[model samples]
Target: MTLGEILAVAAVGISALTLWDSHQERVRTEEKAVATADRADAEAAVLVLRATPSRDGDRLTLAPLNPEQAIQAQTILFPSALKLPPVETTGDPRIEADWFAEPLKRARKGAGQKDEDPGDQRLPIIVVTHYLAGGARHTSRAIHDLGYTLEGRFLRGSAVTLRGMSIVRTVKEEGAQAALDAVWTGRHRSAG
Candidate 1:
């Protein structure tokens, strides 16, 4: 080929190389983004567990000793269904299954203890907290969107029981914990 033709061919080859490199970089960037999202999901879950209360009335807030139930509750409480993203951060996702489940379940057991009279039996309530994953901005947004206007900076989930009546708290973690604690402590007893 002539000198001019060779030069033209070389330019085209160089341009192709540049485009390929750019494409590869884009792919790497996308993958990194996806991995980051997954990490955020896991971290958010852990933070919530850490913030959860250790005791709920008569319930010691024991860990969910049942492996199956603990796993299920972790799924239910963390990575919460709320529209908000994680406020805290984590490298790997881990759940405090036993810590979160045991106490609330224990409180339930305590409430069930046969007492003096039918009217005297009191139910128990349990509250759970989750520290947000991701940055403060993300955590704030998640908390606000989730509707947790509490003093602590975390995600909250709760379940309460009164005799056979049961209620699950989705948005108000602190209030739920307080209410649950009151029942467990006998501060609030139902009139039979």
Candidate 2:
């Protein structure tokens, strides 16, 4: 081929390569955007779990914080339509499962004491294990401190299988005490 034809061929090859590289970069950028959106969605779901109380006080409520997230979380956390109880959080690390389930004053005094009334409507924790089918372990830990929210109900039931408890990661910017103080002191709620 002549010199001009050779140069034209070379130019075409270079142009094709540049276009291919640009397309690859665009694909990567799109993938990154999708991944970022997924992370944001997961974070929002986690926030709902941390900030809101249950609706029926028996089934987990994602209300008042972000309703759409709460509904989505309910589907994500309990897909089988299992009944999960409401949770009450406290900064006191000493508070475990029993007293939350039943008052200390109601402890059994004599032998052969039966469990408290199930109809009492107290909050029962519904646990989600770290070992899920997919990559949920990563998202779950990102939201909470990676402990069960309720104390003892991790692995006692026939239907439920739990390995560890997960708790909400207290906002360290304000300290653990302040986040909880807002809840009990009613500062988190608006004055209506």
Candidate 3:
């Protein structure tokens, strides 16, 4: 080939190699972003799944649904609005009457006066659970709704029940401690 043709061929080859390198770099960057997002989603899911609450009668306990994950500590904080104390335990904790029964009764009474259904009353409580999984410590916050049923003649007997529970979010150790402090200090604020 002539000198000009040879030079053109070399330029084309260099351009092709540079294009390939740029394409590969873009692909790698995309893959990394996808992997990071997937990891975050998985961690959130783990927090949600591990903070499941189990209730028996007037008692409640939080444990991981998967046996592999074990809870290190758990705290149940009645809303500051409810004016109830926080309970800390490593075992199943009894649902206190003040935590739900009294507030529910009051709500029911208020609803009755307003011509609303007493059965629609609900009390929300925050639960924090600490667990170690995959060599990392995870703290999760779950909001549980407490309901009550009035039974017997004239609805004299009242029993507290667990209406529902949901994992709202996960926090760092410091944030979790701050939440506990907020509740224990009797501050009227959102813990999580």
Off by over 4 Å in 3: 1-45, 49-56, 93-99, 107-121, 152-156, 168-192
Clash count for each candidate, listed in order shown:
21, 7, 0
TM-score of 2: 0.34
What is candidate 2's local distance difference test score? 0.34
Per-residue error at 119 for model 3, in Å? Answer: 5.6
Total clashes for model 3: 0
lDDT score of residue 56 within candidate 2: 22
Decide which is better by lDDT, 1 or 2.
Answer: 1
Over 1-109, each residue of candidate 2 has an lDDT whose tens digit, in order, gives 9999999999999999999999999999999999998876665545324322233222222222334332212212211112223233322112233323332112221
User: Clashes in model 2: which pairs?
Assistant: 54-61, 55-61, 147-165, 147-166, 147-167, 148-165, 148-166
> What is candidate 3's lDDT per residue for 62-179, written digit by digit as tens?
4566555657777777644444567776655334444556654554354342223356434456667777766567776755444434433355555555443444444454555455
Best by lDDT: 3
The CA lDDT at 121 in model 2 is: 19
In model 2, which regions exceed 4 Å deviation?
A: 47-104, 108-192
